[model samples]
Target: MFSGGGSHACFRDCVEGVAMTCTYNFTITASTAMSYLCGDCPNNVSACSNPSCIAAGGIVRPVTVVNNRIPGPGIQVN
Candidate 1:
């Protein structure tokens, strides 16, 4: 599933000899905001900043690669 923001999905022409037109749509729910929320360390320690750190007894914090970003990267038919 995509993020709250919008994403661009392209349908490229394939050598299979088929049409390359595509269309897609979806709804963004309120939870989208929570999805990217950054949680801080338990004691506000800088060491434990993200969830990844918490795995090692660090902290629990939500992190977003790019705030307000959606769809992530891209896909090529090559």
Candidate 2:
């Protein structure tokens, strides 16, 4: 859920200028490709004041299947 500061900052500034608080909604896709981009935050190049809000990991494991009907050699879920 990373938002570009350009539009967001402008919107926020506009709303705040009117003495109102702005509510922003965002969605983040957790995938390998988005690994470098932190979730719910701006680009890494730009410093995020509240760094704790960003997602820590973006890696997803591939589903494993053994043979045709059985689980893999060491596959176990608890």
On TM-score, the candidate that comes out on top is: 1
Where is the poorest 10-residue window by lDDT in model 2?
68-77
Query: Best lDDT goes to which candidate?
Result: 1
Residue lDDT tens for model 1, 1-75 = 343313443543455765566544433322222222335544556634554332223333343433223333344
In order, what lDDT does every prediction score? 0.38, 0.33
Q: What is candidate 1's CA lDDT for residue 34?
A: 26
Which stretches of model 1 miss by more than 4 angstroms? 3-13, 24-36, 41-71
Q: Give lDDT tens digits, candidate 2, residues 1-78.
A: 334344444343333345544454433333332223335334453433333332333233332223211122232111
**CA error at residue 6 for candidate 1, angstroms:** 18
Return the TM-score for each candidate structure.
0.27, 0.24
How many clashes show up per model? 3, 2
